[model samples]
Target: MMTFKFARPLAWLLLAFIIFVTVSPIGERPNTVTMVDVDRAVAYLLLGFAFALAYPKQWKMVAMLLIVGAFAIEYLQYFSPTRHPRLHDAGIKAMGAALGLLAGWVINRWRETKAPNGLPFAER
Candidate 1:
């Protein structure tokens, strides 16, 4: 089996992409599905996945960072002239983060199970 290593530069690029999608005004217009909310949620989810992929052993840290990042962004919005953060938006973000973390845990657990000499479900 191939040993997969996380590429530091690629990870940084992904982080930059997440930040751009999170704060950019390119999708500020009102529309069905609410592009801003969707993008924010997706960004959070992707961020969680990225962190998990890069540091599979640091799942708790990933979760903490996601929650803190969401809260910080919401707080920042209060001072932004163009944006006022909504409680509902924060709730949506939190839910997205939770779902993303859960997905990451599931994928990681599955990978561990399939690894050579990994403990079987009954043993674990």
Candidate 2:
């Protein structure tokens, strides 16, 4: 399957961002103008997507790590003076990560099915 040259590096960058965001004070966080839940979900979604693409052969492990990392993010927030951790929030993040992983799976499947003759898999 075709893979992006920088997928792994991007994933690492995202992981670092996630940690930074979690630890930073609430007032320091960027204003996305969206609901906090939406922000949390989308962040984890992107993180999972990167990891999935970075490690195409390890999607299952990526799913597990991302989910665990979601909960871990919440747990980390508890140590932050201005942040609070919530199970509901973690759940949302986990769901988003799952969706992201599914997206990566779809992309990989599509690329793998590309025909040798430069046509769609079905046309081959």
Give the best candidate by TM-score: 2
Provide the lowest-lDDT 10-residue window in model 2: 115-124
In lDDT terms, how accurate is model 2? 0.82
Indicate the residue-level lDDT of 54 in model 1.
59
* Candidate 2, 23-61: lDDT as tens digits: 799998778769988988888888888888877777898
Off by over 4 Å in 1: 1-15, 18-36, 118-124
How many residue pairs clash in each candidate at the backbone level? 0, 0
Candidate 1 has its poorest 10 consecutive residues by lDDT at 1-10
Model 1's lDDT to the true fold?
0.64
Position 32, candidate 2: lDDT: 76
